[model samples]
Target: MKFDQKSSDKLFSKAKELIPGGIFGHYKYAVRNEGPKFFSKAKDAYFWDVDGNKFIDLICGWGPMILGYNNPVIDKAAQEQYSLGNTVSVASPVMIELAETLVDTVEIAEWALFGKNGGDSTQLAVMISRQETGKDKVLKIDGGYHGANGWMQREGSPGTIDSDSSEVISIPWNNIEEFDSAISTFENEIACFISSPFHHPTSEDNVLPKKGYWEHIQKVCNEKNIIIIVDDVRTGFRIDLAGSNKAFNFSPDLVCLGKAIANGYPISALVGKNYLKEAANKVYFSGTQFFNSAPMAAAIATINELKNIDATSLMNHHGNDLKNKMISMAKSFDVDLRVTGVPSMPYFRIENDDKELHFKWVDNCLAKGIYMTSYHNHFLSAVHRESEIDLIVSLASKAFEEIIEV
Candidate 1:
C-alpha cells in the first residue's frame, strides 16, 4: 500500500500560513516529496502519520528516542515528576539527584550543569573554557555541527556575520598534523577545542577517529593547557552510558550531552572536571525550563534503564547487523554503498554523488514504510528488535532496486 499524506499535506498548508518558511530549521521540507510532516503517534520503533501511514522509524526522533518512542519507564518517571510539579520557584531535588548521577556516571564529570538543548550546553562549554583560560580563540572541526547558533553555523548559512566566527578556528577531523598546525598558529590565544567524539557531519558520510589521533590531540591539550570539550549531543548515552570519552578511552575537560540523554525530553547537560567548577560558576547560563524536574527524572530513569539492559551493546550488535545487511544487499544489486561511523550510529551513502538518485532512493524507502534520512546518520535504539532489523534490510533491498532502476 502507498502512503496517504492528504491530511499531512493539509496540515502543511495551514502550517505555512502560521509558521515561517512553512517549516523552519533542520526539519524543513527539503525533499520534493518526502514523508508526512506531522506524526499522530509513536510507539516503540514505529510511528504513524496524521494520515495513519505506519513506518518503522530508523531516525529515532533525530537521536532522542534511544529507548524508543513513548517508552513506558521513561514516560512513567516524567509523569511522576510532573505530578509532583514540573518547575518551581527554586530548583527541584531531582535536579541535584540527576547531577549527582551524571557526575558519578560520566568519566570526566566532577560537576554538572543543566540546560534545555544541546546548543545551550555547547555554548556554555565554550564560555567556561574562555573564562578559565582567559582566551578568545575556540577551535572546532571543519564540517562539524554543534548547533544553529551564530558561532556554530556553517560558513554560508544566512544571517551569520564574520565576527560571529572570528575567534572560531575550524580544522579537519582525525588529522593530528592539522590540529597541531592550528594550535601553533593560534598558540596561547586558543582556549578550547570542541568536537564530537566521532565525525558525523551533515549530508556527508560519517568518520571514526584514526588510531592514535585522539591520543595525540589529548596529549597536546594537556601539555598546552588547552581545554577539550566533547560535544556528545547526538552520540551520548547511545554509545556509552558514561559518555563517549570513556568508550573511546580519552578524557575531555568538558562534555556537552543532549538528544538521547533524556529519551526525547527537553534536556541537556554540561559536565566538566572539578577544576573548571569556578569558571562554570562564573558563567550566566540559565533558562526557565532548564530547572524543570520532569526531564531530569526522565534522564535518571533513562540512564538507569540503559545500564540495566546494556542498551549500548544491544544497539551496537543490531546496528552492525543492519550495516552488514545493507552492504551485502547493495553488493548483490551492484549498487555502491558505503557505511561508516560507529555501529550504533551508522551512516550510509550511495557512492555516486548524484543528488537526485539519493533523494529518489530515500523517497522510495519512505514510501515503502521505512523511515530513513539521506542527509544524516540513522540511529538505532534498544527497542529495535531482530524483527525490525530484518524488515529494515528487506526494505533497504527494495530501495536498492529503485536506485539501480533510476
Candidate 2:
C-alpha cells in the first residue's frame, strides 16, 4: 500500500521555498522528515493524493470532518449561502438561528459568540474570564493543545511568556493536587482554570476527570469565585452535541469550541451564560470575519445532521472497534502497543519508545497507508465505515509486528 512518492516530493520542494517548514499548520514536519503526503481529493471516509493513491482517512483534518469529507448536506448549505451573497451588508439571519440552536443544544450555553478559528474563541473566552473575574492569571493544563495563539502558545512556544508567568500558570492534567496547589498559590491572580476536557499531547489515555474531579474543581473555583473555561476545541460536537461535558456531568462557566463545528467549515464558538456574556459587552470583543454567514449556516446544518443521525454513536462504534482490533492484533505479535481515550477518538503510542522511536513506527504506518498527524492522536469520523476500521486495524497489526520484531 505504499503510495507513489515523486509528486509529493516535488510539491514539498516547491512549498519549502515559500514556507519555512514547507507546510502551513501543526505537525508539519514532526511526524515525517519529508512532510505528510499531499491530498488531491477526498470523498466520504477516503482521500486520494496527487499520485492517485487512495487511503482511509483517520485524521479528518484533525477531527473537524465528523460527517466525513464533502458531505452533501453541509456542502449544499454553504453553496446556497454563497448564491445569496456570502457575508451580507446587514446581519445574517442565519446567525440568530445558529445561536438559538447552540443555546438549545448545549447544556450551559446561554449565549454564543462567533469566531473564525479555535484560537480566536479560546483567547476570547480567556478575555471574558479575565474581564468578569478581574484577575490577571489563568490556570491551564500542561500539554493540552487549545490552539497556536497567544493565550495558548505563549506558555511553551519558542519565544513567548514563561510557563510560570504572572498571567498564566500551566499545570499538568489529572493532577487534582497540583491543580489545588496552583489555585491556592495564585488564587487572586487566577481568573480561571482553562483545560481540554480530554488531556491530549501529554498523556496517552483520556483518563476523564477521575470521578468527581470536575465537581471538586467546580466547588473550589466557585468558592474562590474563579471561572472555569473548558477548551472543547477538539472534543466538542464530536464527543457529543453538547460536547464532553455531557458525559462528564460537569458544566463550566465558559466553553470555547471549534474543529467539529460546521463539519469542517471555518467557525469557532465561545459559549457562556447570559451573566458572563454581559462581560463580553464591556470588553472590546470584535471580529469582522466572525459574522460571516456561510460558516454559521453550515454549523447549524452540521448540528442538525448530527442530531438526526446520532453521529456520536456512529463515531464511537467505529473508533472502539478500531482500537480493540488493533490492540488485539498487536498483542498477537507480542508487542506492548496500547490504545487509549474515548471510543469516538483514540490516541496510540508504543509503550517503551522515545518520541523519535514512536515517530519511526508512525512513519512506517504512513508508508503502509495510514495518516496520523501526531505521534499519539488519531481521530475517527462518522464516515469511517466498519470495513475501513477493520482495514486500519489489520494494517496497524502488521505495522506493529514489523516495528516490534526488529
Candidate 3:
C-alpha cells in the first residue's frame, strides 16, 4: 500500500528552493515520509495525491472540509459571488447575510465580526475583552491552542519574546482549583478566560470537561467580571449548530469560530453577546482580504446546507459507527484502541501509552489509503456516511493485520 512519492519528492525539492521549511503548514508536523505531500484533487471524504493514489480524508483538511471537497453547493455560492465581486474596495452585503446567519445559529452570538483566520478572531476577541474590562491579563488552559498569535502561543516559542506571554496565565484543563488560583492571583488584572470547550491537545488522549467544570468556571467568571471567550474554531459547527457551548451547557460572552465555517473557504468569525458589542465596535482589527465577499457567500451556503441536512447529527452517527467498528476490529486483533473527543471529531490512540506502536499503526493506515494521524484528532463530515465508514474501517482492519503480521 506504499504510495509512489516520486512526484511528491520532486515538488518538495523545488519547494525547498523557494520555501524556507519546504513544508511549513501544520501538515508538515504530522505527515510521514510515505504520506502524500501534495494533493491533486479531493472529493467527498477523499483526496488524491499527485501519484494518483486516493485516500479517505479523515483529517478533512484539518477540520475545514465539513461537507466535502469541491462541494457543488458551496463552490457554486463562492463562484456566484466571485462573478458579482470578490475583493472590492468596499465590503459586501453577503457579509451581513453571513453574520445574520451566525446570529440566528450560534446561541451566544448576537453580533458577528469577520476575519481571515482563527488567529485573527482570537486576537481580536482578546483585544475586545481587554478593551471592555480595562484589564491587562488573559487566563487560558495550558496546552489550549488559539492559533499562531504570539500571546496565544507558549511563552518561548520561536521568534516570540518572553514578554509576548507576560500577561498570559496558563492553568490546567478541567481543574477548577487551578482556574480559581489564577483568578485569585490576577484578580482585577485578568480580562478574559479563553479555552476550547474541551481538552483536545495533540499527541494526548483528549479529555472532556469533568462534571460541573464549565458551570464552575462560568460562575467564577461571572462573579469576577472576567469575560468568557470560548475558542470554538476547530469544533465550531461539528459539536452543535448553536455553538459548542450549547453541547457543554455553558454560556460564553464571545465565541471564536473558523476552520469549517465556510466549508473550506478562508474566513473566521468572532461572535459575541450584546454587552461586548460596544467594545468590539471600538476595537480596530482589519486585514487586506478580510472584506472578500466570496467566502462570505460560501459561509452562508455552508451554514444553510448544514442545517438542511442536520450535518452534525449525520457526522456524529458516522463517527460513532466508525468508533464502534474500529474498537470491535481491534478487539478481534487483541489491539488496544481508544477514541476520544466528540463523536464527529475523534482522536485515536493505542492504549498503554505506546507512542511507537501508535505511530506504526497510523503509518500502516495511511499507506492503505485510510488517512489517519497519531497526534491530532480526525474530523468526520456529513458526506462520510455508511459506505465511507465501511471502507475506512475495512482498510484500518487490514492495517492492523499487517502490523500484527510484522
Cα lDDT of all candidates, in order?
Answer: 0.89, 0.80, 0.92
Between the candidate structures 2 and 3, which one is better when assessed by lDDT? 3
The TM-score of predicted model 2 comes to 0.94
In candidate 1, residue 364 scores what lDDT? 83
Instruction: Go through the candidates in order and give the clash count of each.
Output: 0, 0, 0
Question: Model 2 off-target regions past 4 Å?
Answer: 34-36, 154-156, 161-165, 202-206, 353-357, 401-406
378: Cα error in model 3, Å? 0.4
RMSD in Å for all candidates: 1.5, 2.2, 1.0
Measured with C-alpha atoms, the lDDT of residue 27 in candidate 2 is 47
Candidate 3 structure lDDT: 0.92
Rate residue 404 of model 1 by lDDT: 78
For candidate 2, what is the lDDT? 0.80
Which prediction has the highest lDDT against the true structure? 3
Show the lowest summed lDDT stretch of 10 residues, model 2.
27-36
Off by over 4 Å in 1: 29-32, 353-355, 402-406
- Candidate with the greatest TM-score versus the true structure: 3
Q: At residue 196, what lDDT does model 2 achieve?
A: 81
Residue-by-residue lDDT tens digits, candidate 2, 247-311: 88888988888998898899999899788968987877677777788898899999999999899
Candidate 1 structure quality by residue, lDDT tens digits, 253-288: 999999999999999999999999999999898987
The Cα error of candidate 3 at residue 283, in Å, is 0.5
Residue runs of model 3 more than 4 Å from their true location after superposition: none
